[model samples]
Structures are given as structure tokens and as C-alpha cells.
Target: MSLVKNLLVSISCTTYNHEDYVTDAIESFLMQKTNFDFEILIHDDASTDGTSSIIKEFEEKYPDIIKPIYQTENQHLKGIKASGINVKRAKGKYLAVCEGDDYWTDPYKLQKQVDYMESHPECSLCVHAGYVVSASNKEIQRYSRPNKINKIYTAEEIIEFGGGLFLTNSMLYRTELDRNRPGFFEKAPVGDYPLAINLALQGTVYYMDELMSAYRVGDSGSWTVSSFSTIDNKIKHFDQISIMLNRINQYTNLQYQHVITRTKKRIQFYLLVEQEKFKEALKEEFKFIYSEFGYKDRARMFLQGYFPGILMSLITIKRKLNL
Candidate 1:
């Protein structure tokens, strides 16, 4: 097995009980065709399933490139982020992130991003378009920025987008930025959004229109599935997100105050709706943020507020019909 002498890119991945999907994620990293050497840094947070064994298998096969960190206990439960561990261990010019459930499709994905970042010194981060796949690895929808054209987004815009603007697997950023992480990041509920804001503050963020990676949704042990599992869970998660935004506000010296304020209000409105407190959500204070919702959301809120019994009956019927 040949070892990499000078690593140019470090593929950072975090996994937990991803037995069914972890193999695809690992294989995707190994299949990458790049001129410069790259290392795969996988942090398995005490996976109870076969994920650890599968990772050990890959490490045995590609001993030089695969670096596995096996945890006896799950750090995530201890409020430690597995992603940060891989980021700290990354010793490369660029850091690429792809969680265990997500996989990249294009072999040239790393090379392309590296080439762009190499030429463009102002770009601290580079992200490309990708697909949102189901738990079964079936394509569900495209995960991408709003515009189809490749463009650079400012720090203010990154703050306004609030995280879901780009997929995590598609991210390739400068590793140096993570060395001195800001205090705000520690308080963040999720790492990606705050990290994006942190990077954008350092330099411009580049968005490429190429389709490369796939983000798996509805996967077990994933943040999305767990956060949206119940109304209480959602409220707690959203509250944490709001706190993160406040930290970002302070970190940026309130330069993006207006945007941050609006973003928090939007979250507030969302939380109210999620709690089925439609009367409060429809109040005058949250009225401004109502424009953020779609037709279905508006209709549902109206029904829940005015015709709650009817709405509950409809929900029960839908559940009875298994819809």
C-alpha cells in the first residue's frame, strides 16, 4: 500500500450506525481521481451497527490513505461534535466533508474544487450542486443553491441563507480556517451553518453549479430525522438554532444585524407553526414573517387556527388511509 507523502486534501467524514450506507461513502472517497495525494479521515462515533467493521475493512485495504478513529463511547451524546474531531486531525491544504450517509458521485469532484480554490485565492470555501437522496440511495431531489450559475456569495448573504443553502457533502474549504475556530462555533447547534458563516467572514464563498455529491435524507441517526421527530424535539432544536444565530450576530459585530434579526423571527414563526400554535403564529408580530411560508403552509395554518377540529379530523383520516 502506497502512503501519501504530501496530502493536498483531507476527506473528513463522521459516522454513527450507518452500516447500510457507510460503505458507499468510504468507496466514494477511495474512487476519487486526483493528481495530488489525499487522505480519508473517518471518525466513527461508537457505531453500534456494522459500520465500524466496514470502516476497519477499508482501513485494512487502504492502510496508507484511510485513518479511522474508533470511539468506545459516542461523543455526540456528550455534546461533542465528531466533525470537529476530523477537522482538527486534517493535515491538508483543503478539507472536504462528506458524512457517512452521503456519497459523492463524480470522481473529479475534489480535483475540480481544488483547482478552482488554487486559482482563486479569495475563495475560502467551494461548494457544488448535488442530489438529495432517500435512505435507500434513491435520488429524491436536487440539493443546490438557488441560482444555476456559478457565483460568489458575500458574508452577509451566507449569514442570510442560514445553512441549508448548500449541501454538506459538497463542501471543500481551506483547512487553515478551522485551526482557530471562533467562539461562536462552540455554541452552535449544528456545525455546518456557523462554519460557513465563519469561512465567509474570512473570505468569499464560491458556489459551483456542477452536480457531484448526494445528500441522504431520512437516514437513521441523522440530525434531520431526529430533530423533526416530534414537535418538542423540533422546538428544542429550533431554539438552539436561534441561539446560534445570536452568537453569529455577536461574532460578526452585528454587521449583519438586520438579516440576523429577520432570520430569528423566521425561526420563531416556524417554531410556533410546528407547535401547532397557529393563533400565535398568525399574530401581528409574526405577520411579517408569514410571507416566508408557502401556499400549503398558509392554508394549513389558517385551517389549524380557525377550523382546528376539522383539521385534526382530516389528519386522522389521512393517517387512517396511510397517507
Candidate 2:
């Protein structure tokens, strides 16, 4: 019998054209040293590359622990449809996510997270800081959590710090909560942020200040690196958050507005970048700033516009020179 038969901690790994890195990701999970039980669910989304073969190799070696799902036909669908398929089939009390392009650095990552969750009933979700590495696993930057970890973050806090939170690769949450709410990952651009936000609403979100995973960057396969300036991409991204806010209309109006304000600020920032209109961009960004964000953010946006281009240039140069 499988050790994970009783304890259901499913590691759901999604892969697509990550032939170079999928093997490492699977191997990392297989190497985890846990007292409890866990299973590896590898979902190959019709990778038209050597990704399938890599997964097959792992499956052959560890057939009992590793469960591989290889799609024969390439499902061109993005977002929830493609990724959610794997998550829906997961059979674990808790789900741990690690995409094919990323891998866990600490072998005890699952054990530590599961232990914390099991002890702390109030924590619905647990995440750890991760190192941002290049495609070759060279550390590009380190993402660390704030000194604060036990505090609950509002929707606004999450939206503003979404980039820092990273993706599901560094996350572990209750499985029943996700399975029951199938629409969790149905959002666009990606559903990790919104899903975490919703989960936070249910209970407290705990952050383990350890660097447990290595987030491989420079992957063209990621949505953030993809072309998001197009109208269709913007619309899809906007629609997802809008739908999420609508779903939780009864929760708190202020929270919904916080999400909206954050979204608008991001849209404005992107527009400014794409349009190359720093002045207009500053104005658009200022519109979202209110008493909620305090005078600091407002002052920053104002300075972004008021500062002369040459001054901004000098500051940028100074930073580069200092570095």
C-alpha cells in the first residue's frame, strides 16, 4: 500500500513545454522527506517537446508515488481550463503546487508546511518565500517575506503585493476548499492571486519566512512574460477580477473597491508603459490614490509626474551607477 493512502497531500505539478526543467521539478518532489504521506500528480498539458519523456522516466522509476497524466491532444486553452483539469482530479486533504518550470529547494518543504497547517487550524493557506532564479537555476533575486507574517492582509494588500506573493508554486492550501469551489482557478492571466485572496477571506494566511522554492524566471511560457499589451489580454485580465468581486459582493464593499483601485492602478501603469506617456500615466495612477493608501502613495504618484524627465533619467542613472 502507498504511504500516502491515509494522508492526502497531493503535489499538483503542471507542465507544458518545460522539457528542460520538468525532470528537476518531479525529482524535487520525489526527494521530499516527510513523516506523513504525499503523492505527486504530474499533469503534462500536451507538451510538444521532450517534456513527456522526462515525466515518463520519473513515472517508471517511482510508479507508486508519481502519477503522470499525459494529454494526447494539445489543449490550446489557457488559464483555468488547462490547469484546473489536473487540480480537479487531485485526491488529497491538502494540495501543494509546483509548476514544471519551478522546483522546491528544500526537501522538507512539504513536511514543514503540512506540519504547520496541521497544528494551526486557523491558517487556511500557508506560503513560503522563494528565490527568483534564472532558467539555469542561477539566483537572480531573492523574494523574502516581510517581518510580519501572522497578520491578515486585505484584498488591497494582496493586489499591491501580488508580484511578491509569486505563484502557486510556493503555496499549500486545503484541498476540499479548492475542489468545492471549481471556479477558483477560472480567472484570467492567472488564478493564484485571486484564489489566495478568496482563501484569505475564509481564514488567516500564514507565511513561512523560509526560502523553500526556486522560481525559475526567463521562461517565455509564463503568462506575465507573454504579450499583455493587447486589448484581448487586458480585457481577459480585467474580467477575471471583476467576476471575482461580483461573486463576493456581500462580503465587504470596501474590499471590493480596494481590489478595483489596485487593478485600475496596474492598468494605468501598463498603459503608461505601452503608450510612453509618463505624464498621462501619472495622472491615471493618481486617480486610484485615496485616503486608503494614505499620502505617501499619493505623493509618490505626484512626484512621478512632477519630476522632470531629466531628473528621472538622472535618478535612474544614479541607481544603475550605484549598483
lDDT of 1 by residue, 165-265 (tens): 77888899999988888888877788888889999999989989888998876665677777667767767876887888888788777888988887677
The candidate scoring highest on lDDT is 1
lDDT of 2 by residue, 4-48 (tens): 556569898888899988878988888888877777888888889
Error of 2 at 256 (Å): 2.8
The segments of candidate 2 whose C-alpha lies over 4 angstroms from its true place after superposition are 1-3, 76-80, 144-152, 182-187, 228-255, 284-323
Candidate 2 TM-score versus the reference: 0.78
Full-model lDDT, candidate 1: 0.79
- lDDT for 260 (candidate 2): 57
State candidate 1's TM-score: 0.86
Instruction: List all candidate RMSDs to the true structure.
Output: 6.3, 5.9
Specify the highest-TM-score model's number: 1
lDDT computed for candidate 2: 0.66
What stretches of model 1 exceed 4 Å from their correct place?
Answer: 283-323
